[model samples]
Target: MEKVHFTEEKATMLATLYGRALDSREADPVLGDHAADEAVRQIDYDFAKLGITRDSAVSVVLRAKPIDEWAADYLRQHPDALVLHLGCGMDTRFQRLAPPETVHWYDVDYPEVVELREKLYAPAPNHTNIGTSVTDFGWLDQVPSDRPALIVAEGLTMYLTPEDGTELIRRLVAKFPSGELICDVFSKLGIKAQKLNTPVRRAKATLRWGIDDPHELERYGLDLMSSLDASHWSTPDVMARLRPFTRFQLRMLKYFPALARMANIVRYRF
Candidate 1:
C-alpha cells in the first residue's frame, strides 16, 4: 500500500476521494466510481478519521455529476478543446468523461498529489499531468493556448484567498480565446461555517474565498451563464438513491433560498 503524508488542504483531498469510494460501495451508488474505490484501497490512510458518512459521500458525487455532463457537452461542441482540471485531486473525471482523443486534457495539482495519481491511474491518450501549484503562473506556460479551454475547478475556490483566486480566474480567462469555466463556490456565510465541517475541520484546512454573487466573476472577462444551488445538484434518480433523511434535507433546501444559495455551482463563458 502507498502511504500518504498530506496535511492541511492537501489532506482534505483524501476525504473527498474516500467519500467517492464510499459512494461507489453504496447499493444505489451516485458516482459508481470504482476507480476511486480502487484508489482508496491502494492508499494506506485513515479514511474513517475524516468522518465522511454515506450522505456526505453521496453529496460528493452529486456535486460532480452535473459538472461531468457540462464537460462532456463542451467536448461535444469542441472536440479538440483543451481541458484543464484545476486542483484535481484523486478525481476520476477524465476516466468518467472519456473524452475523444482529439481533446487534450491536463490535470493540474500539487507535485505530491500528481505523484500519487501517477501511481494509481494509468496514462490516457492526449492527457498530461502537470505537478505544480495552480496559483503559480509558470505552469500555465506549459499549456498551449491555441485551443479553446474548458476549465473545471471543483471544491477549490474557497481554499484560496480572494486575491489569489480572482487572479487565477483572470489569468485563465486571458490564456484562452474562448471557453467555459465550471466551479462550485461557497457563500460568505458558508465560509464562516467551515469550522463546523467535519472533513475540513479534521484536515485543518482554511477556506478563504466565498463568492456570494456569480456575477462578480464578470470582471475577469467572463460572462455569467447559469448557476445551480445545492438543491439543483441532484435529480430524482440521485435523490432516490440517497437515504430518506438526506432526501428530506435536500428537499427542504428548495423552501429556503438563503440556505440553498450558501453553496452553489456556477458556470461562466469567456
Candidate 2:
C-alpha cells in the first residue's frame, strides 16, 4: 500500500462504510451519491497510511447515520437552492443529492482535497468544485445572491477556531440571502477530553469549538431549528423490525443522546 495522508473524519467515515450501511437504511432518506465509490477509495488510502484497521470507523459511522439523513432532507426541501459543502473532503453528497440542473453546487476545500475529488470523482453538470480554503470567500462570489442556500459542514467545525467558525457563519449568511446550515459540535469539555485521549492526541488534530450552549450559534447568524437525537429514527413499529441488539441501542439512543455525542449532529438555519 502506498503511504498516504488521511484526514481524520474522512478515514473514520470510510472505515464505517458510510454508503454501504446507508444502502441498508430502509426508510432513511438522503439522495445517494455516485462518488461514494471514490470516497471508499480515499478512505482505504487513509486507513492504510494511518496504520489502523477499519473496525472503529465502522462503529462511528453506523452510530451517526441520522446526521447523513438530515443533510439529504435539507437538500430535498431546497432543490434550487445553492448548495455549499464546506471543507468538503471526500464526501459524495452533491453526487447523492444530484440537485436539479437549475441548482448550483459548490464543493469547497483545501487544494489537495479538491484535487483528489476532481481526479477521482467527476462533477455533474450542476456541480462546481472549488479548490480553496473555506476561510477564503472566492467561491461565494460564484453563487447568485438571489437564491437561498443549504450549507452542510459535516466535521469541519472542529478544525477551526471558534472565532473562525462564527465568522464563517456570519459571512455565509451575509453572502446568501437566507439559508440552512447543518453541522456538528463538541462541547469545550468534550474537546478537552478528546485531547487527553492518547490515540486522538497523537493524531495532532485540534478540536476548536465546543458548545455548552449550542444556541450560541445564533449570535453568529443561524437560528436554531429542531434538535435531533437518534430516537428521531425510531418507533414501536420500527422497534418490531429491529434485531434484539439493534433495538437495544436505539432504546439507549432515545433516552441517551448524550452517549451518542462522541459524535453529534446539529441543525440550523439563517
Candidate 3:
C-alpha cells in the first residue's frame, strides 16, 4: 500500500478522490470512476475519517459529469488538442476520456501530489505530469504554445486569491493559440458559507476567490460560452440517477436562484 502524508489543502484532494470512489460503488453510479475506486484501495489512509456522506459523494459526481462531458467534447473536436488539467486531484479523466494519441495531456499539481499520482497511475504515451504549484508561472514555460488547448480547472478556482486566479486565467488564455477554459466557481456567498462544508473544514483548507460574475472573466480575453448553475450542470437523465435527498436539493435550486447559483461550471473560449 502507498503511504500518504497529505494534510490541510492537500488532504482535501483525498476527500474528493474517495467521494468519486464511493460513487463508483453505487448500484447505479453517476461517474463509474473505477480508477478512483482502485486508487482509494491502494492508498494506506483512513478515508472514513474524512466524514464524506453518500449524498455528498453523489453531489461530487454531479459537479464532475459536466466537466467530463465538456472535456470529451473538446477532444472530439480537436483530437490533437493540448489539455492542461490544473489542480488535478487524482481524477482519472484522462484515462476515462481515452483521447486520441495525438492529444498532449498535462496533469499538474503540487510536487508531492504529482509524486503520489506517479505511484498510483501508470504512464500513458502522450501524457506528462508537472510537479509545481499551478500559480507558479515557470511551469507554463514547459508546455508548448502551438496547439488548441483545453484548460480544465475543477474545484480549483475558489482556493486561489482573486489576483492569482485572474492572473492564471489571463496567462493561460494568452499562452495558447486558441482554445477553451472550463472551471467550476463558487460565488462570494458560497465562500462565506464554506465553513459549513465538512470535508473541506476537516481538511483545514481555505477558499479565497469567489466569482459572482463569470462575464468579468471575458475582460481577460475569454468569451463566455456557457455558465451552468448547479441544477443545470447534469442532464435530466443523469439527475434522475441521483438519490432522493440529492434530487430535492437540486430541485430547490430552481425555487431559490441564489442557492441554485451558489456554484457553477463555466466554459469560455478565447
- Using lDDT as the measure, which candidate wins? 1
lDDT of 3 by residue, 125-235 (tens): 899999999999999999999999999998899999999998998899889999999999999988999888788898888988888888988999999999998777555
Reference-based TM-score of each model: 0.96, 0.75, 0.96
Q: How big is the positional error of residue 41 in model 3, measured in Å on the Cα after superposition?
A: 0.1
What is the Å distance of residue 231 in model 3 from its true position?
1.6
Give the residue spans of candidate 1 off by over 4 A: none
Between 1 and 3, whose TM-score is larger? Answer: 1
Prediction 3 global C-alpha lDDT: 0.89
Q: Model 1, range 151-205, lDDT digits (tens) per residue?
A: 9988999999999999998899989989999999999988999988889999999
Cα deviation of 176 in candidate 3 (Å)?
0.9
Q: What is the lDDT of candidate 2?
A: 0.63
Better of 1 and 2 by TM-score: 1
Which candidate wins on TM-score? Answer: 1
Q: What TM-score does candidate 3 get on C-alpha atoms?
A: 0.96
Clashes of each: 0, 4, 0
Higher-TM-score candidate of 2 and 3:
3
lDDT per residue for candidate 2 within 1-270, as digits (tens), equals: 223365554343333334333433435323234345445544435333332232222233442455567766876787778888887776766655556787788888877667767776765888888877777766567667888788888667877887777888888889877888887766666687775533345455567677756787888878888555434544465456456776787678657656545445678888
lDDT values, one for every candidate: 0.90, 0.63, 0.89
